[model samples]
Target: MTAPVAGTTPDRPLVRTWLYAVAIATGLAGAAAVVHQVTGRFWGDLGAYRAGAVAAATGDGNLYQASHLTPDGIALGFTYPPFAALLMQPLAVLSMPVAVATWTVVSVVALVAVIGLVLHQVGTPDRHRPATTIGALVAALPVFAVAGHLQVGQVGLILMWLVLADLVGGRHRRWHGLGVGIAAGIKLTPLVFIGLLVLTGRWRAAATALGGFAATVAVGFAWRPADSAWFFSGGLLDTDRVTGDPRTVLNQSLAGAVTRVADDPTPGFVWWVLAAVAAVAGLAVAVGQHRRGDVLTAVLVCAATGLLVSPVSWHHHWVWWVPALLLLGGHAWRHRHRTATATTVGVWVVLVASTSWVLAAPGGWDLHFTGLGLVYSNLYVLLGVAGIGVAGWRLRQPTGPPRPATVDTLSGSQP
Candidate 1:
């Protein structure tokens, strides 16, 4: 066995303290901005969230009736659950600068937490753990998904943190499903975690998740009855809830790729067939990984499945890809002696981290493209598909791999 590295775990408390000080200072700055009613022209997705919360908090307008224009000059609707708006009421109180500042700070903290938890899940050596997580966080800085989240003040980071903490932290076992439930309330994507809990035979936690979700819906209805009713009745049921054209490269879902390939505004039958295949195959692989003591892989498979199945998966929505890449890196390192597997995983990691394929593509992302354009536009979609295939293959491999440093300890801690 390798010996521990110097000046690593011993300095954790100092690193943690420094992190706390930064967060406190940032929070104080945000509070000052709110008190002074500071304003700026930093319109982005956070503006929509703030506006939605304003409507929800002040009842100035209908939440679902019409899209609201922000200082940034875009008419965007609040495309999240009522509970999310309720949670963001604080943003309604914040100025644009404060909102952005606070959000950036929060997103950074969550990102760090996610990296640490993921490294823990994989049993990264304690000596290398801090540096690895810090390095991973720095590496994530330029990734399109992560950068997009910080730029637009998206909630993806916070939601990812909630799920990982509840499932992998080993600190909240008694309240296992609460975080998943709350995250699902904020955005519907995390609902997949509840299914994961069920599949993993964590029945009590799954029920708690559903129960928590029900409570959120109840709160939404209580606070804004008509808005909640309308949202759940139509917006949640149908595919379109201000989601842009499915053909756009911004949409990295399987449906997005299918629409582009078939040149259909709505690639109905084929999209469903492919989605169904992905769901079955992906879920099976996830279950296999979980049973084989690889809970992080299972979680990532579920995350990737949600991205593929959703009608719209914006670049920022791929935040969980951070952890996915970490796992891929670990796998590549362990299998370095095996040329094919190592090279494949290493190349895949590069592809996953590089955002240039989509960034450098020609304009008119919504318009149809031929030949190489299709590859550029559908890069992430294809990656998701291929990732599932790779996972399935790994599951079936007969190699007696080392037992995973899985999250079962955390799960088992749940009462």
Candidate 2:
């Protein structure tokens, strides 16, 4: 007789499962549409970019230039690099409403797909189906909200999915690296992952990313060398000041929070020192975990650390955590009765609640009141630190991988 697959176990009830998934997805879609129509924009950053691109295309001239109005300015289109502008060409051709709507839907779908894959990998037999659906739906709401609010996070969702897929042995690691590198060329923050690849001994993946970065820089320089110079000379430097402005409330980074707190100029050195120390420590921990063959943990820790340690980060950027969140949830479901499972669930609740509350808060509070953004930003930082701490503690514990004997006993085999 053929042997039963170990740990395959049982599945969830199909009918109820599908219904819940569909309802959640529909709700998210409706919310996205409602927000879009009411705001006359997708979300935050997205609205700014879509409007700026439209302005540029309409002969309104380069909106990133200082000559442009604050509402219309691209905020250093020069810093955007040519390939980024090139990537937006299609959207530039389309109407704002059409582009924003299309982008929102596509990003939402991508977020779902990534969550589904992560759930499948680590989910419990009973929870797999429901968790897959619910996680995706949960992630989608914030995803759509962010997109509708800022027009960012779509890239984040894509990058997170790509990195997870690659680490999970998908055949397209290089391609994913390339895509993320292009995103880095446009956004800068994604560059942190390159350090992760190197530290984790992924030489080939690192090479692929390096190649992609080079290619983007070359193409960008070739297309508009002057723009490249302008970007590096003025835009990158000015980003600090522009982002520090009280009106740009969307920034959720430690730097942004610090900027809001200072009455006059405080020592920038202090903030940089904190960020640097945190980053190094986080990277060391993540790399050590990766060396121990905990790819999922490594990725989760590193991704969270990247954002937490960055001098500048926005809430929309937190979208990258969807995969990690699902991974933690799936681990809980897979080991529902265990101590680790309880810890996982507790962390999930805290992180999810904190994130949801912060995202829903107004950007004005994020910009004007130092205390409000400080609370949100510090909450994220603390959670990230605590999570890595928990993960490290778990590692030190004597828990072993489930044994074949346990599987045999569970399956009612003679022992």
Best candidate, TM-score: 1
TM-scores of all predicted structures: 0.84, 0.74
Look at candidate 2 and tell me the lDDT of residue 398: 61
lDDT of each: 0.73, 0.56
- The true-structure Cα RMSD of candidate 2 reads 7.2
RMSD of each candidate relative to the true structure: 5.2, 7.2
Model 1: which residue pairs collide? none
| lDDT agreement of model 2 with the native | 0.56
- The sequence of per-residue lDDT tens digits that candidate 2 reaches over residues 273-311 is 867877887788788776666666777878777877666
